[model samples]
Target: MQRRNFLRAAAIGAGVTAFGNTLTRTAMAAPAQNGPGPYGPLQPANANGIQLPAGFTSRVVARSGQQVAGYTWHNAPDGGAVFADGGGWIYVSNSEINPGGGVSALRFDADATITGAYRILANTRLNCAGGAMPWNKWLSCEEIDLGFVYETDPWGAAAVQRPAMGRFKHEAAAADPVRRAIYLTEDVPDGCLYRFLPTTWGDLSSGTLQVIRAGTATSGSFTWGTVPDPDGSPTATRNQVSGAKRFNGGEGLHYANDTAWFTTKGDNRVWQLNLAASTYELAYDDSLVSPGTAPLTGVDNVTGSSSGDLYVAEDGGNMEICVITPNDIVAPFLRVTGQSGSEITGPAFTPAGNRLYFSSQRGTSGSSSGGITYEVTGPFRS
Candidate 1:
């Protein structure tokens, strides 16, 4: 299709939007329950190898081993968060290396150009995925035994590790701003979902770590049990508890719309936990759906759209970004083509919701040594 004609056909209910295509009835519309919105079948990517819906375009902001300013762009850029800085924003990315892995902070201009990049936390192990706090801090998780989550300033500051939050291959965390609670996910096959209730809100130095025990399918009333060892030692933390509920592989977690949305890689399931009602329910389970029906599998890092929908990234195969609508319908939002075998991680949107930032943990060659951070811009619901 010609560029002009393609743009014309892409326009649906909305006026000419900058990015994101409006879903037409023929373009993989959401389940009947989910009303129309600004998402549909992906258009051929104009960029090197990424396909986004019409109006949406992406640019490679940072690539592994690329030197920008003083620091070399970190390899294996895992989970990250975007924070509003002076005029533009600072994107903090994690390095998933074994011995010298840590967090790197990049300063971008208002136009999203890299101004400077530097290492904030160094000498950590397998810094995988983490979340941002309500108080303007990024929690970088170390996916290792007895690994601690480091709270670092996104604008280049020293990091303080919070061991009280529990260990055992931590993946990501979500903060409940209203209740001052932090929800965490473990990355092991028998990982347990944890919640830390700090003595004082926003203070992570001291807290009571507990695990969830669900009574219903995915939603409903749930109970909690204390974790005897927040730090793994003689016995693994998950194994220490007698009946601590286990998620196959708790990979990514995000808190939005008064609920906590998370994914389990082992089972390819996305779950929703109502913070107010204290219940958990399965929102999307790929195993329950026939093969080739769902675009999402190996669900990894996740973020929230302005419309209260959840954007989930695939870790291994497929390499697609899937959206879970408010009514629980899951569909394709974007797919990474040319980047062979690399999984998507760290899907975060700016506060304005106009731009979405994420990283390809393994670069185009699918090697751990290469990775790239990218941003997609268009009309994202706010």
Candidate 2:
């Protein structure tokens, strides 16, 4: 039987999902477990530029170049994640600006009200999409040659860079709790899908980096090949490797229900990989599915909802957060109007799962210098 079949069987027949002793029996994404219908049409957010489903409300939590409570909110805010704190949680966001780029964190109360904001990591370059770890930390990635992934403490503690994860135009990463592995995506036209098998689970200091070779669509077997040089040297690591499979601008990554989901911006496709068997299936392809059916374009950042649905942020298209159902039907979940050229990013949820958070990489100005982080509250799935 195919790997996907095995996963489905284990999830249904045994009433649990398991992945290599790393994962415990847990709920599938909220959308998949509770949904088959798309979200309702969007209602105008305001002249400040945002749209969302009825009953849903949004508020700006942080903005570029602004000072909040003695800390400066950095420019070009990109990928981010949320971690549970005492009564509330901490939201850490990446600054995609060069030279001065870094990561920032915000404190919120149980009511989703912002408490304070501060910078966590600094003096980096192009910190882009990153993933939250099972160990309660954030991996901030830089989009540059020999770029490294930084493990940052969400509480403004110390940060250490991990080059063992491989160096290239890094885009995003997702950790498979069951497999104890970190899956990564690159942002080049011919980027690759990779995974880092840490010498010890939950430790990013040492790991073996390998890239995946694609098989067929929706049900292809996958194989991994070692990355010659994880830290790009005289010659960039990606260019030095041979026989490594390439993806079209690999972008956002997330893990749900024993599967690793990633997006490819070049072709606007999202792939679902079964971690145990290392196999993948195409989840959504905009090119194959016309705009009339699914208006969302330029698929970039992705986040999974407890309802088992996936929310995708557009990098250039309608500037909307599109929802992808388990059945693969697509519809607009949230749209940012008046921001013609900017993209929506950093979609995350608080630990209690009551609030949804995201960012506009570029605000109404449509320039990198202008960006805003937002939080939305509604009847989110439990």
Candidate 3:
């Protein structure tokens, strides 16, 4: 544990102090109907200006334009994922800057020491949220109207463009090997959900891109229709297929347990799609929150844990990362203070589930260059 202690003390110096480790779970301070979430109510904001549950502590991992280990971190850090190496792990983050958007990575050893920092994808525009593939590839997405997905390697390999995934303002992607498909979300106000079925399970060279076909209901039966052109030149992908269901400002996505969960920022709702029954329903809607005003809004990048706890990060609403448990309870697990102008991005858990990594796309100064990445460690439910 000396290494971890060193990480708190000397890893990033004043920017990485840890706190709020000595409190008991007596009572909570959230909605009453569904009770408190897994970690109980959050304590006062710590040195990093974050309010976490008792026994949980946070540290600054990287900051925009600041040296992380040696290399300067990228601005507007967004959509990140962790990949396990032999002994260490790599966390790759995408830059949301318009002209020079790309992907930057932070490498950490087994003891959490910053071994190195580098860029994986370069010269790309508006690189936003992405997903970590089962085969160790990072599917970095773009938020532009005609952006493409870049399959970048976590171990410093060259990046490849995956245009076969379709084009039209992509937000996030989640692969489901059980169904042999990768689900995608669009960022437009009335964007349609999509799926790319590769010719081979592990390869992404060629695939049949399809869109979800359903009624306008939040929960219902659905089907997929193939898109004639993944390129979306003369006709955009969303308008190519008839009856394609529209989501209000689709954002992040994740696949697990034969279900694909995605978020829509415009409506502040997390949607659940059951692959087995072809059914879709709302997992969390701020308007439907019970017994109090919904504690979550500005819903953005979402990631889940082994315990079925879905940690949903906010884009602006109080800058909190709310947890939606399997039992349908939603509560604020942690909140970042003085970040009202910034949004929470890339809420990902490590392979061992011991720590959570994310970033405030714009820090307290309310500028892209002020972005800050953080890691929170505690007794996360396993």
Candidate 4:
């Protein structure tokens, strides 16, 4: 098995979602990243205007409207994930530009050098956060009213739309291989958490979408109810299900080790859903930070390393990617100093876990046209 998959498979989730526990939160992040991080303190801003730890270096990989090698990079780059290729790997990113949003991919050599760049999906609208399937396809979602999810080929094949996943304001998708279900998040105040169970393991052509039976449930464990209409007709899919638990502005999601971790940008919180138990809790809550200092806010776009460290990027706060250890300590791993106006997005580590890639959706100009993608390399823990 690949080292990355092996690490995740070997992880033991801290599941507090026992069979008889009420819907409650477990304080995982204390003081909101005020503790000493494994990476130590970030050094002063370097030439790239980034504050990374000692021994770590940053370099610009691509910029909006600028040609990366040959292909022009897209604007408003958002959620991203990495896929393993023959000798190297590929990094796929979503473009959050309206009217002409889409997805793009960058090819890397085994040495982590960019070999090529190209578009994967196009002619879409407001393409936002997405999930990488075990089957190696990218589920690019749209963050608009009645949006859709497009499953695009990471290797430049034609994209296919999968409306069976629902047509609400989709933000992000997380596939749970253990349950053979795809968990989805809506980008609304009262949005619902959904799961699409395909007829088969790898085929997403058709499926039964269900909503979490929460909100009003006063039971030890929660369950899911069928979404009368996955098409989301007159009655929106979210509204169709009564008492479906609402996630405030859900932005990013990632599933591993039988636990699914997601973020709510509106509340500046990271949630933990124990798929094995069907119960969820707060992994990191800014409001619960001790001494009232929340180092990690604007919680968005979550990913984990093979070492079991959870990295949550900020959408607005300090433009930092805070690491939340399995032990629950949260601290800044890196920071973009001069791009305070731009939000961080698409944080993903390479398959070997040596290089980390992400983008500043608006860069220094703080406009959609000024997106800047970056790569950081060093002695990473995993």
Candidate 5:
């Protein structure tokens, strides 16, 4: 077996031994019950610019261009996921810049301070957003032409970039172990949602790529239209792209409850794909999605909370972490402070869901030290 697969199996086996059942089985057996509402609005941070609720605190986990493992830091750090390995924190972060900053495999002590950071893959182009694997590694994806997905070890070695998944402008990826497949997002005009069915369950290299078909039109015959078109006329025709889309800038991806939730930076919409049923549904249309007094806007990245709620990071507009409750009410769960006018991305929860971590990139109106990571501690009432 490949070292990656072996490590994954061993981790799953250990989890099974500890829990006495499969992770998904336990999750489905007892659905998460809703807790109380969020703990008020976000509290502003001090000089560090980290923000959380009243009871919670924020600290610097790591910074850009910082030296570690004999290599200097890179610029434009983007999507990242947290993994638990024998009681340690393993952070897999991406560098979104061209000749992509490369993936960073960092080990943190119990206090969440960076102990070591090393390059996992080098000389790659535009390593954008990625998701965490169930067996405990990170799926690093390239977002450039003919982009590919690389499955890397938590320790930053033994890497393979799988191109069979697709060759378009790939953005982000989310793995669904229950269905033994993966969902991918493409950043292009009239961009299409895709799924990869692995030939072997839990193995990512061998898979078939398929695009999503939606709208009232039949398959392979749908067209794309601009958002908020003044004409109010809908265009109908297959808007498929041979390689790139004119406007669809696909970005964030997350899988939960057998469905894949994704976001498009161009249109500001959150879509869901029912994997088991092979159907598409609109979870939120940013053009029309209004949560409480705050309408959903400028969504960048998204992740599932332990209570089954989805927390979306807004990269534009108000610069806040918005939570979409089970009832479809969108509100500001955490408003970012310190770095005003900065864009927030990557809102991932720890394995235990006791803490939430997010990153903020430099924006148009503010001067930032590259980016900042924050930890929010609370009940995280979904």
Candidate 6:
């Protein structure tokens, strides 16, 4: 079945409740393993100075500041997710600039090289990060104070800004095929996590926007809280004040196994929201926080692998790709060094999971010395 039709069906089934339901039973079943090279981990190199594991290799897929079909020059590209069309085509999201910039629709060949690039949305601001819809469309979100969610077609033609999802500082988004709802993150102080119930699941034209309350879904109030001490230490109760949840910049959201995984850049932590129970919990503790110990590296953008592994794009300190396995082992899967002030973003795996694509942005020195999309070909052992 087509992804869009599937999502619409799931959304109708999910609306049985107002808050939204977890993915259906069949959708939650274990993912199937198909077509690949080997089961071992390997890394390689590319034109860009990115270093990967033993068997993996890297290449420059696309670069920023380059002139595409509609724009004069490409600005900062952020939060990319992969959409594998049935015809061996890949559509990537280039979160466009703020103050009126649109998302970039990039088409890639089977080898993962850029075939075409064009603008989808225009005259927007802070097009931070977004996820791929099951129907093969891209949902680009604005991260500004009065941001709105925009839906773009795979060819960069059809574009619509959805206001029902709430007008706030938006961040990353993830679509749950089972529930037919899209999970959203707000990149603001005291921002709340939200889920939008589309009046018609696959059709994002209209929906009901609701925030995730801590205690239960029955409560209509949108409450907030900080990451308390896991060991039960005496800490002050932080209220859900306007912009009180400092640094909880809700970024990098993805859904897998009936749960939602997201990153908190401000507090330097990753969390998992169990939709089944309407509860939130930490997926990776402070120990594995970005810029933390070995394995699990720090990151600014993150996505899920085909095998259920979590790939984090390290945006701070060390420029590397970190992978979180189902067993919770955090480790550096790839590293990008030698480039002046270069940081990695948008770590997404192809549908086959054989190739991993990512982008590097201008380093802290304000130089575009190393802005490129890298392809890591290897057996990503989950």
lDDT of 1 by residue, 55-140 (tens): 88898888889887777888899998777776687778899989988999878788877788999999999999998876778889
Candidate 2 residue lDDT tens string, 91-196:
8889888898889988877776678888889999999999887777889999987798999998888899998998889999887757778999999987888889
Report clash pairs, candidate 5. Answer: 187-250, 188-248, 189-245, 189-246, 189-247, 189-248, 222-237, 222-238, 223-237
Model 3 steric clash pairs: none
Off by over 4 Å in 5: 1-37, 68-72, 111-113, 216-247, 290-293, 338-341, 363-369
lDDT of each: 0.75, 0.75, 0.81, 0.80, 0.60, 0.59
Instruction: Give TM per candidate.
Output: 0.87, 0.89, 0.91, 0.91, 0.78, 0.76
Task: Give the worst 10-residue stretch by lDDT in candidate 6.
Answer: 1-10
State each candidate's clash count: 7, 12, 0, 1, 9, 23
lDDT of 3 by residue, 1-382 (tens): 0000000001101111011111111212222124587887789999999999999999999999899888999999999988776677788899999888989989888888889999999888888898877778888898998889999987778999999999889999887767889899999998999999999986999989999999997777899999999999989999999999999999999776556778999999888776767878777778877787789999999887756567889999999998876555788999999889999998877666688899999999899999999999989875
User: Against the hidden true structure, what lDDT does model 6 obtain?
Assistant: 0.59
* Model 3 worst lDDT window (10 residues): 1-10
Ranking by TM-score: 4, 3, 2, 1, 5, 6
Best by lDDT: 3
Model 2: how far is 336 from its true place, Å? 0.6
Q: lDDT score, residue 185, model 4?
A: 88
How do these models rank on lDDT, best leading? 3, 4, 2, 1, 5, 6
Off by over 4 Å in 1: 1-37, 215-219, 290-292
Error of 3 at 364 (Å): 0.8
lDDT of 6 by residue, 1-382 (tens): 1001000011112111101123222222111111122233424544456666666666665666655444333456676766654434554645445465566656666665566777777788868788777676777888776677888776666788777666677788888766778888888655667777789978887666655555322122234333232111242112222333233678888775466777877665676655555545566654533343444445468776544456677766567667655444566677776654666776766655577777776633445433565567776653
RMSD value for candidate 4: 6.0
CA deviation > 4 Å runs, candidate 3: 1-34
TM-score attained by model 2: 0.89
